[model samples]
Target: MKYPILCCISLLGSLTAFTSSATTCPEILSSKQRLLNSTENIELCEAFQGKTLLVVNTASQCGYTSQFEELEELYQTYKDKGFTVIGFPSNDFRQDRGSEEQSAKVCYLDYGVTFPMMARSSLTGSSANPVFTQIQSQAGVKPKWNFYKFLINKQGKVVATFPSSTSPVSSTLKNAIEQQL
Candidate 1:
């Protein structure tokens, strides 16, 4: 979907206007938290209701890249139980800068990513995103690298944060995600 110049500018503006701090991510999302998904650029939270989301900071060229297979597997296994993995493609680590269209193509073609994909951006540090800021506020430790996962329970609350090394198929993640379901 094509975003109007106004929309793009507004998103950047809202993000930029945010007070730069170590604990300011949640506020940004709470205020301007429209969906940043790939599908028509729908509102992220709105498109997903009454569901448990596994929000991951993803990259196309990371060692954990293969986790996409396990992610898809987990999604297929628990999706009926109201669980999903939301992929947020990021270049924060300087690993992925492919266009959104290309991201969708490569994700599906390479990793077989079937879940929702967000637009590309940073995920940590002073240049962190509103969503990540919120996750960090709740999850404590920030992402170490690409493939780091944040589990959001059905009520839209941040429940747990996993490092990038956490495999998608690990019983640890599955159990954590299922506990809230």
Candidate 2:
């Protein structure tokens, strides 16, 4: 009888986890990503379902690296309005080199980034991370350089792709973001 009860408990726990995960992410978005500054992997649906996102490929040592400040400004400005900016530190362009800790310090300590940032991962080519692959597949664009941004709507669809030169404060980007909000 005790064995049967234990099995039932295990099954119930599994079902609960499955149900929550299923409801957390929209079907259009790939839900898996490794969090920055840590060893944990996350399901995006679980963490950011129904939110507008500015997904950016970032580098710590690039000419565009200072965009982190504007990105953080955007994040702070619209976070309460269901907007978030997720940064992915990528070394595909050979701009960022250091431990994850060092990279994170640049984002958190130097730039004051408060939004979620993922671990270092490729953002272009065949070896790109799954999330980037999905974004590129749907959006029909790829990052030509660091700080390329994709704006995703609340329904998890890519609404626009902003090139590296587009400032976070650009009225065009801001208008696109405001529309989603």
Candidate 3:
């Protein structure tokens, strides 16, 4: 009886996969990025297409570093509703020690971040990453410090930018997210 149930479950899983078709990622999200502490490259569009995103430029050593907990809470609450919090660790402000391994440890082990965090990259100026560059051009804002956040809608548009002092759990941010969803 147990073996039959297991077999049926496996068969159902296979059938579900067979019926589902893969979605093509949008051109805007086609840029390849690396996960923190790993060399594997991932296409951003394939991973987060059709999702409302809260993009944050984070630093492990910053004063507002505790926001990681709130960010994780936001992800836990709204993730099921097609919302995601994306983090990119940046050391441009000289707050971080410029170490990927340490950043990964703080994000994964210390803060217990379940949301996706990319490798360290510049968040402002000429050396900024493509994602940040596009966001700045569209929103007319640049990160003033570590922990700056940019909210992106499902259509890949920068809807809002929050400064370092804004908490991830703030009603203002939550309301903005709810509007998109």
lDDT of 2 by residue, 1-181 (tens): 9999999999999999998867757654556778888989887776778899999999999999999999999999999999999999999889989888989999999998889999999876777887788887888888999999999999888999999999999999999999999
Task: Assess candidate 3 and give its TM-score to the true structure.
Answer: 0.84
- The true-versus-predicted C-alpha distance at residue 160 of model 1, in Å, is 1.6
Please, what is the whole-model Cα lDDT of each candidate in the order they appear?
A: 0.75, 0.89, 0.88
> Where does candidate 3 stray beyond 4 Å?
1-28
Task: Give per-residue CA lDDT, model 3, range 42-160, as digits (tens).
Answer: 88987898899999998999999999999999999999999999899988988768579999999999999999999999877788788988887788888999889999998889888
Clash totals, every prediction: 2, 1, 0
Clash tally for model 1: 2
- Model 1 weakest lDDT span, ten residues long: 26-35
The true-versus-predicted C-alpha distance at residue 24 of model 1, in Å, is 21
